[model samples]
Target: MPHVFEVGELTRAIKAVVESEFPFVWVRGQVVNLSRPGSGHLYFSLRDAEASLAVVWFRGAQGGRISAGGERYDPLTGEVYDRPLAESITDGMEIMVAGRLTVYAQRGVYQLVAEVVQEVGAGRLWLEFEALKKDLAAKGYFDAARKRPLPSHPVRVAVITAPAGAAVRDFIRLGRERGHGAAVRVYPTLVQGEAAPAGIVRAMLRAVADDWAEVLVLIRGGGSLEDLWAFNTLDVARAIFAAPVPVVTGVGHEVDMTIADMVADVRAATPSHAAQLLWPERGMLAQRVDDAELALRRIIGTLLASRERELAVLARGLAWLSPARRLDRLAESFDGVDKRLVRAGTGYLDGLSRRLADLEARVSRRFDARSLDAREDALTRRVERLTAAARMFVADRQQRLELAGAHLAGLDPAGPLTRGYSLTTVARTGKFLRRETDVRPGDKLEIMVYEGRVRAVVTDGGPDAGDKS
Candidate 1:
């Protein structure tokens, strides 16, 4: 009899043969019967019109073999990708996949263990895009150092887009609603189709030649990759690069990016977003203006208050240095001196009278009646001389005192009031009104005559001042 193998042994032998025969291969077909279970593995069938093959892409092998290899790095693009291939897969989509061939021992069936998967049609476009991107990047077109800063307050902006597109309309509306009074000029262009690249380049060049805009905006609505391919053209990219003014691009939705977006000075998610980046919010700007006005008022108020305090200090100092104040001080000194002079004169007279009485008493005790008479006559002569001398001294002091009083009276500020001249002063501040400009109409005034002060309100402040009531 012929030798027979066990079921397990047969399955194992087939698995070894299939894995060795086709270790790695690439397949192209329409995707069908796709399923992703909780095991984080993708199960799908790739079928052409005639044949179908089962495929399994374990999660570990989608981006990279995490434990077996490092992160998924693409040598062609010089970038790392962490996305799962399943994310791009859909039923009935034409896809190309590459993986190793293996046989499942449990089911004893052959399948493809896919490592990479991409849509066929889009993959070609992606390859072109990547090649261009690599070339541009090598030439420093995508360098951050080549990028420019946006203007803080752009006064003139040129918009390049389809005039009838909703993207341009939204941009214009947002600009009007939120911009800081910028003059927006639309440079209408075709943003799609085979001629779109040339149109965009022309629009950019025209806008630059006009030199009317501080910045240029290139914007378009979201669309399929083919629809937005114009922005990825070399002509458009070069045109944007050679623009004299800074260029801002808003080509599509946030998920979409193009070469124009990369080379632009700034990139925005949508046309409306570009407007927002260019101009500040109207309400927010108004609030800032109001805040600035309030701050200015506060600064002015603080300055005025500081000046008023200084004026008050100067006024007090002026009052202290006034002639009238000096005159008052002089009068007080004069009064003090006069009182001291009177006291000294009265004391001297009392001492002389006491000496004379002592001399008369001595004569009464020592001389007889004849000698006493002679002595008395001599004492009377001396007394008369003393009295005459005292009279002269008193008369001299009285004359000197009168002279000083006359000088004091002349220096006195109030002396003029005693005459016909009257003094006018501000009733509110008690400041002397020396000039016509000192008072304004409706100011209260006080008039000082010989008797007393008269209160009045200024009716006219002119060369000839007039007051009433």
Candidate 2:
């Protein structure tokens, strides 16, 4: 089969086929042999355990953290720049690259021209993980003080997992075989995808609100970084941290470590390992039960033997005496003991009755005395009040008499008369002249003496009686 064409024409035909067959598709891989070109383009190989794919992103796009211009070189690689220089990205980071899948025509090498790039960083999932851990820590949720011991015998086990997956089947089978007698509730959801984080959050909320499960088991089968990316979301991490019941996370193969594993109360390497952790082997449990039975039987036998020995000792003490005489004496002794017991009991009862009666009588007497004293005090207070009221009434009468006397003295105008004073008046009018200056040359006044009345005329405006009136 050797039909030949010109070299350029052949190359052109091959290029056309490549472009037409594969337009553009999203490819996922790990970062390897990574480089940041001077122009700020990322050149790296995205590979898994299987094979590697070449990927590139422009500087304006995601040439690395903090915007690439004027950034110093990384000493490890000594390159002009680093792709995804953000703290979030590292060499071993698992990620998904989305861009046009293109192949170099001459070299036949394929590479993705990335339009957008994000680090499948654990901290993204670990962000929720750490946040929830902080919250729970502050609230003493994960404190040793609050931890409840696992139930020795769990009647029911609630599994929060994807249905029909390897995790669910393994748990149920292991649980049943181990004779755990556990009623397993499989709550299924997408383990990894855009929906996974939300699904995990809802399951956790419902479990806490409803009190539905005793313990929770979260499991996912092994997968590549891109396939398992959802488990790394913050929502999923927090959900595990916030779950009320103790959570056991069984995720990834032995190699893959996830944030869920770290935050959960327990981490199982595989879904099968998770089941084994919850329940042990039935044969081992049966052996333990048998051992317990044998120990209990030995203890019971020892107790019975001790009782028999006590009975035998008592019997030996009663051996071989004069039968009738002994019997009579024993009967009499038993009667004496009975009489003494009765007397003791009767005496105790009588003493108790007397004490009770004395207490009751003292209480009654105290109550009666207190009541009578209160009444006497009240009566004494009333009597004192009545005496004070009488005194006040007499004093009030005395005050009234004193006021009447003052009124009478004022009406008599005798206060001035008692002081050896006399009155004068103008002869023409009834104006009393206490001062000689009050009288004018033409005025006349009248005056009332202590005993009678007089009228006179003013003869002069004299200064005073002492001044030759």
Candidate 3:
């Protein structure tokens, strides 16, 4: 027979399958039948032309959607945002949502637990960015093997950014605090607007021609996809790729990925991070130095202690090698041998005395007549005890035999007749008559006494047969 599942069991199984299969998804549809309950949760259905799906957005679960790049960003501009878009969902609004699929066990229905919702519009810039990224990737511009390693500690670092921008200022400040005394020289360029692509390329060419810096750092702050399009252009990507020295990019926010970032040797989340990547932190370096000094001191102490132990051992050897020490050691050895000889002689004499005493005891035991007489008396007493035990055992057995024979005589059936009690039975059937109802009047019956049984006919057989007699 097929197994039957309880209602709760079936619901839980469905919940697990639905949740695991569609843990996260993006769905676009028109919202309908929206509800705002007092529990601070939004319940609704999203439907396309063909089908509808239920969606729930709990207040506590409401949050921004993270992109495939491992961070959240605006759906249109591609700039990172923190506020949730679920609050803007209304009745009959067409939107795109990202969430997970799960079953509501109480209602026995599956719904999307929406986290992020976006009103669909103006995504051309994002599309163009994706197309260029794909093209550059196909050209092997984003290969890991093609990327160059940055110097361990660059003495001079070049920044290709607007001289007055916060990105440059943040970079320089972080460099001063964390760097190993590396000089930062800014190469001025436009970071946004139509002229930004060409201006960035020019700054790169200038830095490459100068060739004074060990590494090139390109940086900018966060912006919409349109504002950051210059970094996504092929011109800037090619310039970073063709640079003589290694190029590091920190454009836009951590979530933003531009063509230049994909092509550069290293990518940092922000301007501060780029500087951090370029040089080791000053405090960290100091800590490392302190740790090394401590370890070195420990090593030196261990070496000195080992040498002192060796010196002590050598001093003991020298003391033992002296003539006086050797004479004292020989004198102690001679005293030990003399004491052992004395102990051996005393032990031998004690063993001989013990043997002589043992022989004298054996001779006295062999000649003792009283012990033999006492043993004979003990044997006679033991024989008397055995004979007494046998007599008592036979007497007990005879008494038990007599009692058993008396019990058998009492169980005999003839004993009751001998006591004047008679037994009667039907003569023809040989059945004992327990009551008068066993026979009718004139039926033949037998009366049994101690000696013999006598046959007779029943004259009256009724309920009052005994009273009539």
Candidate 4:
């Protein structure tokens, strides 16, 4: 008889075997029901193109501090996606995951315990679309500021679309019909499928990354909204947003709408319309070029005329600055001032000096000649009168002297003697007297008491007479 094992024992044995066999492994798949409970445990169904398995990640599985949110990626299609996501977890735009693949023991299923998730979903993409639209609109990126003036002679272009799609034919037709080379570069990519988002995003990044393409013409012939959903992804939107060059999106038919059209720098209703935005018709461009040439000629002519006018004005200025004219003006001014100064200084000094000299001469004439002559004449007459007076006085003195002499002669003693007045002689005494005493014997006397004096003896003249001598 075969021994039967209990269900719990069987499950435990299976768990032991499964863990022992698959302890360290990695599995990639998509989640069907991704959920988180309040107990901090994660539960989900991880599947692939073949089959799906139930999964449970217990709270104990996380070492500590486990978070609930990650991005919810699109279901895997057995193709490896190598593109790196932009943002990490806790960014609100949750991603499904990428991490260690583990199996649950109690549930008896294989599952994916993801480390990360990325690439936003439909609802996430829609939210991003609304948010970006509002943001760019507020910033006026959708306004006139970000819009560049389209080139009229856009000859070479890089076309971004499915290679075999109808959009290529439309671009080719439009480029040729405009009589322009539109040199289209067809970069083959998936417009719709698992790889379509990355493909479109890559094409967009390249349209700007490559230096040849001036303005990008993102064309798709026409499509329904679902057919163009790859273009609506946030990945595509981000790629278009980051394009350095200007982007031109012509995604769906005129009636349909896609997020690519919204995020693009410029949007056209159709692929044919993108051509119009990029290049005008060749005929219009040629006409414009011709017009520009003519304008340049007219500007040259106007500049020449203005230069000629300025030259004439400069010549007139030069003529007005002649050296002879300037010298004459300065000379005239100097002459006027010099003459005035000379008249004021010399004329005043000369007139005053002349008047002063005349007054001085008149003053000199009033006293010098007449006064000097009259004083000389008066001094001479006075000197002559004084001399005459002195001479008269001398004459008077001489007359008086003569008269006095006559009187003296009249009184002379000799005359008296001659007139026989009285002559006495003393005998032997030589005495003369008016009355002579008698002379003594032996006395001799002779007397004459006048000019003719007689020698007389002194003996008789004293007492008795000198008669006794």
TM-score: the better of candidates 2 and 3: 3
TM-scores, all candidates, are 0.62, 0.42, 0.47, 0.37
**TM-score pick, better of 2 and 4:** 2
Q: Write the per-residue lDDT of candidate 2 for residues 6-47, one digit (tens) a residue.
A: 866776776677667766655667888888667756778888
Local accuracy of candidate 3 as per-residue lDDT tens digits, 196-290: 99999999999999979899999999876677889989999999989989999999887777889999999998888898899898888999899
The candidate that wins on lDDT is 1
On lDDT, the stronger of 2 and 4 is 2
Tens-digit lDDT string for candidate 1 (1-469): 9779998998889989888999888798999999989987889999998999999988876663332134443332222346645676789989877789988888878899987676675556667898898999999999999889899879899999999999989998988888578888999999999999999999999999998999999999876567788998999989988988889999866666889999999999778899999999989999999999999999999999999999999999998899877887888999998998898789889988898888889889999999999988988898899999998998899889989899888877778988878889887667998987777777898898989989899887844565432
Scanning candidate 3 in windows of ten residues, the lowest lDDT window is 118-127
Please identify model 2 stretches exceeding 4 Å from their true place: 1-148, 317-469
| Candidate 4 local lDDT, residue 229 | 68
Q: What is the C-alpha lDDT of each candidate?
A: 0.84, 0.66, 0.81, 0.62
TM-score of 1: 0.62
C-alpha root-mean-square deviation, each candidate: 12.8, 39.2, 41.0, 49.0
Q: If ranked by lDDT, best first, what sequence of candidates would result?
A: 1, 3, 2, 4
Model 4 vs. true fold: TM: 0.37
Give per-candidate clash totals.
0, 13, 0, 29
Please give the lDDT score at residue 17 for candidate 1. 89
lDDT of 1: 0.84
